[model samples]
Each structure stands twice: as C-alpha cells, then as structure tokens.
Target: MRDSKLIYYRSGCHSANFTTWLIMDVIVQDVNPAISDLPCYWNRETSKSVGLQSTRKLSCLWNGVDVYLPFNFIKNYFEIFGAFSLNHGVKEFDVSHSNSRVLTPSSRYNPREEFMHFASFDVEGRSRVLCVSAGEGVPLSTQWNPQGYFYPTQIAQFALAHYSVHSQAQHRENIKRYTIQLEQEDTAARVRDEDTNSLVIQFKNTLEFALSSPHLVLSLDLKINSDIKTWFKVQLLAEEEGELFTLLYTQSGIYIQSDGSEFQFGFGNKASGRWLRLTRDLFTDLKKGLTHSNDKKKAKKLKRTKLKVISLKFYGSGNVANISLSDGEDLRMFLDGANWFLENQDENGGWPSNVIFNQGQKKYPKAAEIQPGWYGAMCQGQAISVLSRAYHVTRDQKYLTAAEAALGPFQKPVAEGGVKTVFLDRYDWYEEYPTNPSTFILNGFMYSLIGLYDLQNISPDNVIVQLLFKRGMRSLLALLPFYDAGSATFYDLRHFTMQTAPKIARWDYHTTHINQLLLLATIQNSTVLSETAERWRGYMVGKRAPHN
Candidate 1:
C-alpha cells in the first residue's frame, strides 16, 4: 500500500464524500530558485536541492489504479511533499479528509484568475503527503517582503514544517475552602452578638475573608429596621487595595457599587423590615465591573492576585446572618458549558446556531450571503476542546463519545448539509459561517484546528480524527498567507466574495488572533508563527507594516 501512488482528490460532485483517491503517477516539474531568499529556518542546502521555489507546475501520469487511503495513513504520516496541483486535465479533487462531502466551489473561486503562485513538489514517489497544498504557494522568506508585507501561505508553510504534536494541558485543580474573619474598624460601631450566625451591628464593623482562588461566591443575609433611615451598607474591602465594592440595602433600592474602582450596578427596592438574602459571584462581578470601569490601571490591577476580601464594613443599623464564601465556581461554569455541548449536540454531531446571520449581506452588498441554522467550525472545535477537558476531569466516556460524535457534520459538505467548504477546489476549510460564498474566518478555523488537536490527544487511535486533524493542518498552512494584510489580519476572507474593502479585525479580535497564533506556534514550534504573533501584538501599540 505504501508503494502505490496515491492522490486524494474531490470530484466536482458536491455530494461525493472525501473518500475517493486515484492511484496515479504524479510527475511535478522542478522550479529552482536562489537559496538566499529562502526562509531563515530552512537549511540552505536542503532548500536548494528541493528547488523550494513557489512557482512550479505538475504533470500527472494518470493511472486508473484505485487505491483507497486508510485512516492509518494519516496517523503515521505528518508532512506533505508536493507543489500544489493545478488544472491538469482532471476534475478538481476534494482532498478534505473527513468522510463529509463538500460544497461545490462558489462561483467566487476563479480558477483562471491571473495571480498564480506555486510551492515545491517532490518528483520521487516518496513525497511529503502530510505537507501538501492544492494550489496555494507560500513565500520563500518568512520575513516580511520589501513592502513590509507577509502572506498567509508563508506562515502556513512555516507551521506545517514545525508544528509539534502534544496534548492539551490538564486543568488546574479547584480550590475547595475559603475562610472569613471579623474585625471591628470603628469603635463608634457596636456588635450585639459575637456568633457568626447572628450579629447586630451599629455604625462601622468589619468582616475579613481569606482568598486563595478567584472563583469566589459570596452570600449573606441582612435585615434592617425603619430606624436605618441613612442606609445599611456592607463595604467590601480588598486586602491590598482600598474598598472594592459597596453592597448597599436602602429603603429606596439595593445597589452594588465600586468605591475606589468605578462601576455601579443597581437592583430594585427591598423592604427595610424584611431579611434579604444576597448572593453574588464576586470574581465575575468584580471582573466585569473592572473591565467596564474603562480605567486601564484598575483593569491591569484586576489581573493581579484577587485581593482577599479584607473587610465587609457595616454602616448605620443592620442584622447579619448566614454569611458564606466558597471557591470553585469557575470550574462549575466550565463544566456547565461542556454539559451544554453534550445535551445540545444534534443527531448529526453538530451544535447548531438557530439564529440568522446577515452581517455579510448587510455590510457587503456584493457578498453572496446570509442563512439561518448554520453550524460553525469554531463552535464544533471549541465544544470538542471543552468536552475533552471535561472528559479528562471526570473520566466520562459520554463526554468523549459526544466529542467523537461531533465530527459528523465535518464529514458532510456545506452543500450537502455540512460545515465544510473547499477553497479553490483544493484547500480544505471548515467554515465558521457557511455562507453562499465561503467566509474563511481566521480565528474560527484556527479554533477548529485547536479542538481537533485536543480530541486527537484523548482518542489518539481514532483514524477518522487523525485524517481530519492533519488534513486541516495542511490546509491551514497553505491558506495562511491570504489572511495577512500587511498591517493587520482580516477577520475573514469575505473580501473574496464582497469585493469590498477587507474587514480588518477589531482590536479584540486582533488580540485573539495573536493569542491563537502564539498557541499554534507553541504547538508547531514554528518561528514564523511566533514572529507573526509578536508582530501582531506590536500592532496594538500603534505598529504598522510599511506600505508598498
């Protein structure tokens, strides 16, 4: 089986599964280039011998030998060794690894488009199948071109060569207990009872809680009489900082306000004479408040160790009881998200988005757009990642099974009710939004790849997953250069459909791209990935690529 010539191609028939492999002798023409321009990481001799120029064409020796690609081929192999195949008298082959059928190339894909580039291909039968591309060509140098511009294909090639295989890190153990202590700050205040279960305070009295982890839940019950005309307030003080939050129960209403910090949230009126049970996730509330505070200093400080709640000072008159603090609510939320995937996944192994998306149609009049009930590659991939972690934590076969099942829609085509589309009839791409014209979203595709990595780690022997992951990786490597826009990254390749200005990612999405690239860099050990991440990071601080 190893000796047989194997070429995986997609038929023009959109409903055909990606299972067809034609046994053909592929003879690719060698295009030699100067070694001085090769990426710094490439061995010059190796680059020279391979003729690693990005403008080679292929000559196919089409033999009708029908040899199927076993999933194990993907398991043992990890590099592709060919210059991209062009229009060589054959129907465009859909090499997308999943058994899923793929959408027909949208009319947007111009096969005869003028701008054509190619990557190197091996003439010997022992080609790098894992490092394959369809028609996309990576740049020779990993560095920016003379115009300070780089392309996705270059970054993709860099990742394909260096990407490492490793499992996702185990989740950190959740902290179990947190202790609270009491302190009387103002002598003007008096406590009627010393017991934690029952306390009546006047003026200012303080309660201090030790903090180990940030996933904190704070709950307390308080009662105030009509005599509290001024207000009964619990001032939450952090250990290192000034007062953090003010929990106030007034005759008018209940309010959560930041003191030295700058956020305020109000809840409607609570009757004075009744006991009020107040429960809050302090970490979430504090994080949200601080983030919206729009004060960078406070926001930066929030990243530091969450200060122990040093004091909860009481003002005016109030009775306190059943005060409690607990840790590990964050993990609870994480598990909750995973459970949602388990419960909500469709029979087709996809999580469906019921809402309609018209953003492309609304923004770009030229875009072939909008649809309801689309399944996103990002959702599938991220859910799998979450479920993989959940499986690790609980050792639940169900979570693993659900994750495995989620690969279903990936095998089908967008035209045949799937979340995948082939770019230019060659590169495999999982669509975030399955629009009429493909929107090759950068962040979503990367996230889907990350999820594949996680699933592959737990179920290492799953052949289907192996092919899906490696093929997706190969496609991503070849496709990277297209996402690069010199100064910033495009949110998606919608410009191909819209024919409008490229949609530059917002600062937040730009940061997400940087973070995702950094992770991929660590996975691939690719200098190109790391450099691109760093360069994108610099953009947030006003850096821009020099225009041609």
Candidate 2:
C-alpha cells in the first residue's frame, strides 16, 4: 500500500500477517545543506549520504518466495545506505527496515469490530508472497534542495521486480462499519449496531454469587448491507459457575450452529470431564512448588495482578474526570515505558522524537529537524509512576533510589544539555516565549511528584518519600508565578498555526491544569485546586470559544 494500511492474513494466521511495506534503495549524499540547518548525518565526521527511499508494492513477483531468514535489515542495509528520519532529531535507522502501522482508535478496533479470534495460521498448504514496495519516480541529479529532501523514486524493474499480491484497492474495505460507546457508569464496552459504535455497559455488583453480576448487554440496530452474521464468545471458567454468550441480530438472520444449539442459548461448565482431579491437582501442586523456586521472580503469591490501574475518564471528550475512576492494580505499563525511555534517555532526560500523527490523521515526511520531541517529560512522569509503584509494593529502597536517578539528567546543567534549547526556526526566525517548552520536558518535572505521591501511599518509614515530597512542593510552588494565568489554552509552540491561530497547544497550561486537578481531587487540596482551576478555567472546558 502506498499510504497507511494493515496487511493481516484473511487466511487466519499470526505469522501469516504483515502490513503492506514500502522499500527504498537509498544512497546517502555528501555536504547537503541540512534541513532546519541541523547536521545531515548523526555525526559530521561520518561521510555518509542519507536520503529518502521507497518500497516496491507489486504483487506477482512473490509467487515463489518463502520466508527468507529474518534479518535486522536496518543495521545491515539502511545504515549502509544511510536512511533515517530527520524530521526533527537524527535518530539512526535503516528506512527500509522500520515500517509501522498506526493503531486504530479503541472505538473502531477489533473484539467489538471483529472477534479478534484470528490466531496463528498453518502454512503447509498455503503459498508465500512478497512485495518489493517499489514506487514510481526517477532521479536526474546528485544534489537535493536546501531542505535535504529526496525526489520520488521510479519502479525500474516493476515488471521484473519481486512482487506480491497487488491491488489498487489496497484500502477498499478500510471503511469502519461500527463504533464502541462506553457504558452509562463507564465500566463496560458496548457496541451500537446503528449508532456510530454505541458501546456501553454498567457493572454494578449483583447480590447473587452463583451467576456473574456483570452481564454483557447488546442493545442496537445492525445495518447490514448484504449477507453477514454476528457471533460472540464468552468464557467464565474454573471457580466461576456459569459462562454466558449472546448474539443480537437486527434482521431475521439465520444462526450458524457449532454444537446445534438454537438461536438463543447459554452454557455452563460440565463436571463430566472438566478435568481429572489428579491432573488438576498435579498442575496446581507443580505451580505451588515453582512459586518459591529460583525460576520464579516474585513468587506471585497474589497473582501479581494482571489488571492494572485504570482512570475512568470520559473517552475523547477529556471533560471533567470522574473522581471515582480507579483500578487498584499497580500500573506497570507506566513503569515499563518509563524505564525503557530512561534507558534510552539522552543526557537531557528528554526523548527528542516527534510523534507525527495528530488526532486521527497520519502524515509522513523525514528530516529530524521538523518533528519535535516531547519524550523527556513523558518518560519522566512515567518513571515517577514506576518508581513509586516499585517502592510502594515492595518497600524496596532500591526502587526509590532508582527513581532518584531518573531525574538526575534533567537536573544537569542546562548550559551543557541539548534540551535547554528548543529550536524556534531554521534561520532562528521567531522569538520563543518563556513557557514555550518541548511538551515532555515540563511533563517530566510535573509527573515526578505524581510518582512520589504513589510512593508515599505505602511507605511506613516515609522519610525519603517525605524529602522527595518537599522537593516536589517547592518546585511546583515556584511554577505558580510563571504560569500565564490569563491565557485560556495549551499548545506546542513548535507548531505553526496561522499567525492568527488560537492558542491551543498550551504546554504549561495542560500540565498545570491536570496537576491542579490531580491535587484537588487526589490530594484533597481543594483550596489550591480552586485557585489553579480558576486561572485555567478558560483552558479546561467544553468545546467553547476561549472566553476572556
């Protein structure tokens, strides 16, 4: 596919799926005036020519190709060819090797969109296909424009190029058919057949024990154009007595039977051959033995909680956050991501890569100078979360100690770190305002306190936690006077809305409003919360014009 598209196998297989790819044969240039006036290569010393590249997308060439061994084509190929994303920062990579699909929004995704039942496929009887991803274009010269961009490429051997299943209709059925609406209390996912994905559910505790209290409901009209069937699979096993499944059809539809059950049916676990006691007991006993063994990490005595902390906010609207939204599980995701970013943290503690997609749109143009990075503060907030959780759960001083290390780089002298300077323009055009920061830079500082709050929750000896707490308080207090209290919006300063564009990317306002909201609701600091929110009232509101 020339544009963004997923290439999963309709044949139902995991290894059998891969998105349509674009391949480029790149040749790095020499002494090209870099985009935004930044250096062209990762290092000026390395005489390499890196430029834009393309992939082949023809279908017939892959008639006989099999899985040639999995290779890190990036280091082996792109690095040799000098292809990389210079949209903002010069992160190195083989352009051909790095292909990614933007994940669909939750409202239009599978499970409700499709059953997500597609599993690994058996390919013994299946055939193999490969797309070379070569597009159309021809180069006439050696030098590129001042922006350091490359000309479009031509498919030289397209008729003879390695091709795969080709179709101009690559995005033919890409239209989404339904959307997911949240439940009334916002506890469950519901799908509206006629509505734009009307998905909702309410999980109030049922006084009954034998049956599950959280019943799945389907209330909607399905607008089917042609022949189609809807199916649902639910399993509540082991200690749970009953499992329920429902299929609601808008039309008088024929039901496909697997076990010959009629249109409406339900099933429960049967003891006839559920499991032999010996076998069940054998696995259970083995699991118990393995718990304390050297193999196990934390013994997982309490299941280590697969369910993590979830905030019950109104999806997309970002309106008033429900104060009661929480899942009591440790959010290890914030931790894992934080640790990964920290591990890759540039000396500035900020990740300098721009995430190009906006709202629901996707656009691509390479040159590190254009894409802005907000990773530093995002990672910082995430680090604080992880450190707090690790310390809270285990009372391990090491985790707190590790958390301390997370902010060290950000605190390093700004005169030396690249983070202190956010580029205003290529010729150094416009003047940058004081609060105009790279988004994640400020967020890192703000979230450190959040992580500390998490840590303070369970620490009995809370001394170190107290120290971090005080440090956070002082830093936050210092920020109050710096806030543009009169402004009513938040936005990234790097983006060029019209010179007359409204202020929406208010970086500090976003961080500050959220911080105030957290403190007011979470810490019960209602007095300060009112003060902060009062100033930010214009920024944090419904889709209304900025009321000065």
Candidate 1 contains a number of clashing pairs equal to: 27
lDDT per residue for candidate 1 within 307-349, as digits (tens), equals 5443344455555655556652334334434555676678899
Task: Show where candidate 2 strays beyond 4 Å.
Answer: 1-375, 396-398, 413-415, 418-445, 452-487, 492-502, 505-529, 538-548
User: How many clashes in candidate 2?
Assistant: 51
Query: lDDT value for candidate 1?
Result: 0.52
Best by TM-score: 1
- Candidate 2 on 111-185: residue-level lDDT in tens? 111111111111111111011100101111112221111111111111101111011133223312222333344
Question: Whole-model lDDT, candidate 2?
Answer: 0.28
Superposed on all Cα atoms, the candidates' RMSDs to the truth, in angstroms, are: 22.4, 26.8
Q: Candidate 1: minimum summed lDDT over ten consecutive residues — where?
A: 114-123
